[model samples]
Target: MAFRVREFELALMHRMQDLNAGKVEEALHGMSASRAELRAAHAHWTRLAHAPRAPKGAAALRMALGAPPYRGSRPAGSLTCDVLRWPLPSWPGLAFEALLGPGGEVWNQWFVRPEGPMTVAFTDLTPWACVVGDLGASFPGAVQIEGPAPHHWTVDFPHDGRTYRARFVYGLIQRLE
Candidate 1:
């Protein structure tokens, strides 16, 4: 039951909305992945949706942000508000990031390949960045960082084969150079 990380996230999202959704079934019938793989992921998502709650919006957000991405998911990395160490994800390092607000609401969330090709969100962005779904790498790639003079940086996407640097502020791309 082999499947890509993207597929698992999509299935999990669908299953979260409706446990009985046939989206996974469609994937199986279309041979997108093995029936076993889809079924296992779907089951895991069920447990997440049905997991116990803290009963308050803020508490729930805090709980969810603290909880693992999913059952048995490995630790990825820690959040970096300003100048902090954000060690790259090991190997095919893919991590889901969640930004919380002062009121304990989810301000933003995205998937990051700390050492892979940069997504559009990693470049040419301004205030109120759009939320990007979880993304992963099929093969390991490289990403270079410049500086955060005042909590800003330049992420080089060499894989894109461009001669520009992607500037980031608070993990959101401010512009490209």
Candidate 2:
């Protein structure tokens, strides 16, 4: 999932660069607000690039929870993935998303569609919560509480067109560097 998202990021970067360079005009004319959200996502990925990679799944999970075993061989299971969109002002504020789960557990589903109304939703999710954080900040986002079982938690922002849909699913490594 992270791999795919990386590709998405690259595309977004290219698009943003084109827009900035005046190589590609935007359909929405002024999308500076949307661009800001993309910027946040870009910054978040830049930070993760410097973070130690967990060579094992266990290490990935541990790292997700922000635990010990500070440094050494990277664990395989402890991988963190961020698949978030830049929030539109007409919609909602920007959001930072992180998925932390066991290495083998895959969280696969799209939450929004490109050219459609923007919305956020989570389903068949466990750990009962998701943590949001700012760009490159060690401190995490508000610890959102979840209901029992795989519940569909969603947030609706303003929209002009039809409904948007995107899905994402990935695992978190359990160990640290």
Candidate 3:
């Protein structure tokens, strides 16, 4: 069976369920999708991800999301990586990005701010309002820490002389502390 963008988005939500169940529920209602559908989508994605015969990395993403709208290269330490981005229907301003190593292996996959200026204030730091890049840009010198699970990230930024830690899943903000 072939997976489409909706399934991809559902899979994303599945990863986020642990951190933001209420938000996931709202998204599910917004998509008019049932919990069963979400579970099935995630299962399909997991199978595809692990199947030896299935397309891997960027190819698998292209299979599910179609061709990326943006393709470019970015410097990663001493090496440069190919970056591919595709827009998700639910998040107009954010795009799903995949960083491919020299061998075309996908090193990272997450939502990111597409090329453009992003202005974010503390007031705008609500759940699901922004991506990891938004906070890094808005609050310069923000420190990124790997989260407890895959696709999870925590960014610590300073504001009003206080530090805030924002949790994200798939690079989309889930909550703030």
lDDT of each: 0.39, 0.29, 0.93
Which is the better candidate, 1 or 3, if ranked by TM-score?
3
TM-score winner between candidates 1 and 2: 1
Report how far off residue 25 is in candidate 2 (Å): 5.7
lDDT of 3: 0.93
The backbone clash count of each candidate, in order, is: 0, 46, 0
> Could you tell me the TM-score of candidate 3?
0.96
Return the TM-score for candidate 2, rounded to 2 decimals.
Answer: 0.21
Q: How close is candidate 1 to the true structure, as a TM-score?
A: 0.28
- lDDT per residue (tens digit) for residues 79-157 in model 2: 6543322222322332222232444332431223223322223331212112111110222231223312231222221
lDDT of 2 at 157: 18
Report residue 93 deviation for candidate 1 (angstroms): 4.1
Per-candidate TM vs. native? Answer: 0.28, 0.21, 0.96
The 10-residue segment of model 1 with minimum total lDDT is 130-139
lDDT of 1 by residue, 1-177 (tens): 333344445444343223223433554555565656655765654555466852343233333334444322222365332111122121124455444544445444444444433444333233213111111121124354655453344545443454445554334333445
Residue 149 in candidate 1, Cα distance off native in Å: 37
